[model samples]
Target: MHQLSRRGLFTVAGVAALGSTGALLGASPANAAVPDSPRFDLSGAGDNPVAKKSLHANWVMQSFAYDNVHQHLYFAQVNTENSDRANAGDLWITKTDTEGNELGSMALHNFGHGVSIAVEPYDGSVYLWTEWMSSSSGFGTRIGRFAFADGTVLEKTSSAVQDRTPSIGDTMINPQPAIDPSTGRLLVRYKTGEDQPRIVAFDLADARAGRLATQHRLAERALPSRGAWGAANPFQGFTAYGRYAYLLEGRAGGPSYISVVDLNGTGQSTVVDRWETTAGQSLPGREPQGMAVWMHPTGPRLAFGFHSNTGGVRQASVFVKTQFV
Candidate 1:
């Protein structure tokens, strides 16, 4: 993993401000028809409509989860450290209200790099997916569960990687867990090559028990096009609402988009919607990372966390939006 640093300057813009000239693609049997991208209109919500906030500079926002039951936004931050050495950094999980009010926080010592987070609505338990390196275990990833009320770790289950040769240089990209709100089934994305990423489903019972579950590949249409932006756009973060799964694509300083798909029991996924962030829609020169969704008084709202460097200061920020039906 690369450390956060001050880099080039990129102007920030709004997704809603940019109008679409034509549809990128239409929906099919496995994909939903393309819909107009969500507009970042602050007028409807009144002044100070967009809830923007900054996190500590030492922390890099990796993933996010929202607890609808408790109305809390959970942010997973990984302490920045050199990845070449066995010395791993701690992981901090912070909770805040919908208005960006700080509620509480929990710190895990040498807990590895937190990649993503999800909250179980039924039991209010928080799950954090992490990757780390150790002398004995080599490179590994695990899913950790914590109590939502007190931030107490309940259990952790290692995600076994097949034929994974662990090394200091080995880096893996895993999307944050996508929980099915209706069934509480957790969906995790994993890929090793150029092919479409695989989706693994673990029941809440199995996850709480620390058991491994079945894995399957998402439908081809469900996967993002590799050369969409002159490079392979890997899945950066994930969230699920109703029967659809939302995927974050592209990297910081580049064009980014969100792909929504209908997930099925047979592992086949149907693309429903795709919203690309207009150039300059995010924090200047920052890349969008983890995302979470929740219900607002006006309607359902989506929140995305970003990492960027401005004025020689490396910072983490979040932008929330609504009006994207």
Candidate 2:
């Protein structure tokens, strides 16, 4: 996602090279996917644009992941800004090249709001790893894996769907999936009935093979309690990278923030780093929405995204943190 090359150059950390699975498999891993330092230099980061042309996406972009294989970017957007219709699990996935030229789009019916999405490239084809079976809250009740077929409308009950949702807790609600294409690792962020939010890590291969159902995991870490980010800070999005995971939080006209978590670390304070980002201040209605690790040809990058309403149409933009200190 690093292309300050005047707002452009890279892949989503070997992503959808995780291209819905296989592509992200060979995605390069710098510092073994999870670096000891979850901290990056935000002060020096730039608001590099990933999309060149205007987005054809219909709603506000929620989360996105990369596909290094075909050099495409996948964006997830939910329909209806109204809180009531927001829970319908209906959203559009707009596909585009790294330069932001809209190529095509897909509609997911009754799929949870696209919190976080994983691109897995498998069998010369691509499979999108996302939450499925929208619950009452309009979030995915389980993880769904399916092909990225353009012009296709997939129902939550579609047979082509693969239920990748792991049996985490007795009442796991709204599970989210993030892929560390760098290490082929997957993180599922979920909340229990007690409202305890947690992130569990697993190998992407094992996860794709259904081994997570048997309790095979690399590590588990706790996310901040609900509203812990703050009463005004809305939960935005998250992504997995090697032994670490990253979270995004903020709202329109922000002060957006990025928090890094050590997946393999056992410390009580799993959040080892927190920093406020002013990377996209120039954009109007700059609400932080997406984050992903990208394997740039030059080096490793952490990509963040935002949304703005331009003349009533929700538009999306992206920025990357290329310097890690």
Candidate 3:
């Protein structure tokens, strides 16, 4: 028998089909579950048979978002592979088509750990929402907005980056941001000094117009728990749709989960959906990284991404959960 290549260990053909929407390769795990309200099935087909694609940036992907209007994708990565944010302030922004093919790339200086990014296409141009102002920990200290310029480098304090950190949550720690492409609403998650994890929402237009202070806040709620999953699990990424927020949490290799928070819920009851998924579990060094909403032709897709190492090269692989339960 021929042995599978190192990269082949990550293949999901045993769990999902390529073109079909709801097929599964094997039986559901004993503890597997979907959301109680309405969200994509945890075992929805991993749609892309060839989903693994390389990004323009050589560093591992930290976070990513989709451009529904422009059909583009923006991925964030740091300059070096060390765990201690060795090259933290040095950043790279990779531009790609929907399938992860690199279109071009740019550089950023003193930008925070690219935790999450929101792509906004408007008025014949495109702008990005991401973390900025690298702090001592190598993470961003504020939210920022700027236009995309391939092959160019921008600093955290550059005039092109508009500071968009909202004033609702803890003023100390900078918030992480994601957009609800359906309504153009932006949701940010933040916490201060070991308090409850919090989220605040605002209209992207109001945020971009410098009206965050004066404009009315759309939503403010606490994400009390990440599905009550476990203690060691790490928060990977998050994004919002119409009325729901989807959070990705997991460790490396196996056993990650998606926690669906109903922003309208009160207190600890906010975590309405807690589904454990084995999506991308087979990939080498597979670690869940990002989640976003993709406006697919059939319907909207819940896109989740993972970063893995293939032959010493960091690679990005994206899979979508189409159709809701």
TM-score of each: 0.62, 0.83, 0.82
For all candidates in order, the CA lDDT equals 0.48, 0.70, 0.70
Stronger candidate by lDDT (1 vs 2): 2
Residue pairs clashing, model 1: 13-280, 16-39, 27-32, 27-33, 30-270, 31-271, 32-271, 32-272, 252-287
Model 2 agreement with the true structure over 1-325: per-residue lDDT tens digits: 1211112110110000111111112112311223454455556557575732356544778888888667688989876553554337776788887666788877787788898998888898889998899876788888999999887677777899988887644356778898887778888877654435667677788888887753565565456554455557776889865656778888788688887766644332445445788776777777888888776777667888888776666778888877765
lDDT of 3 by residue, 140-249 (tens): 88888999988777766689999888764245465788988877778788765343466667777887786565234666656654334544677888987776788887
Which candidate number would show the highest lDDT if scored against the true structure? 3
Candidate 2 lDDT (Cα, 0 to 1): 0.70
Q: Model 3 segments beyond 4 Å from truth?
A: 1-38, 80-86, 226-231, 271-273
Q: Where is model 2 more than 4 Å wrong at Cα?
A: 1-39, 51-53, 82-87, 193-195, 226-229, 267-273
